[model samples]
Target: MIRQRVIVHGRVQAVGFRFSARVEAQRLGVSGWIRNRNDGAVEAEIEGEAASVDAMLAWLDEGPPGAEVTSLSTADLAPTGERGFRVLS
Candidate 1:
């Protein structure tokens, strides 16, 4: 399993990014949580098989239709065996 902490910038807030990410993560069998950062960025931690995680990261670049993802930053993390994906307040 692989895990990553991703920070997505630009037009991410108030654009349904979190919900869309949760849906995609679930579909990819990824586990983690996503939330809006105070810096106007969307932050998430995803854990799953390498292929699934990679797919998730790629999807984050596109995000929801209304979302305009300008850039993405990711960091490798140790898996915590997390289950399910969620949107955090």
Candidate 2:
């Protein structure tokens, strides 16, 4: 398994981005957590199969229909072996 840290910017918070992420992550069988950053960005770290991680990242680019994802940044991370997607406060 692999891991990826994703930071999404622009009109992310209060747009159900984290909830959407939980849905997508569960659908893809990925495990990790997502939260809204103090700077109005949504950040998440996902760990799972390469294809699943890729799918989540791609979806994050657009996010839920209400989200206006202007930019996205991702970094490779060591696998955390996380299980079950979640929303962090």
Candidate 3:
């Protein structure tokens, strides 16, 4: 298993980015949570098979059609042992 924390920048907020991420993560069989940041970025922590996690990160780069992803920064992290994917408030 692999775990990562990612911060995505650009036209992410209020663009259904978090919700889209939740769906994508769930579809990929990943467990994590996504949320909006005050700095206008989207933040998420994903845990799953390495390939699935990597695929989700790649999808995050493009995001929803309305999103203009300018940057994505990810860091290796220990798994949180969470179940299911969700959107955080």
Indicate which candidate wins on TM-score. Answer: 1
Instruction: Provide the TM-score for each candidate, comma-separated.
Output: 0.98, 0.97, 0.96
Error of 3 at 47 (Å): 0.4
Query: Candidate 3 has which clashing residue pairs, if any?
Result: none
For model 3, give the 10-residue run with minimal summed lDDT.
14-23
The reply for model 3, stretches above 4 Å from the true place, is none
Question: In candidate 2, how many Å is residue 78 off?
Answer: 0.6
The lDDT of each candidate is 0.96, 0.93, 0.93
Candidate 3 residue lDDT tens string, 55-74: 99999999997999999999
By TM-score, the candidates rank as 1, 2, 3
- Candidate 2 residue pairs that clash: none
The number of residue pairs in model 1 that clash at the backbone is 0
| Native-referenced Cα lDDT, model 3 | 0.93
| Candidates 1 and 3 compared by TM-score, better number | 1
RMSD of 2: 0.6
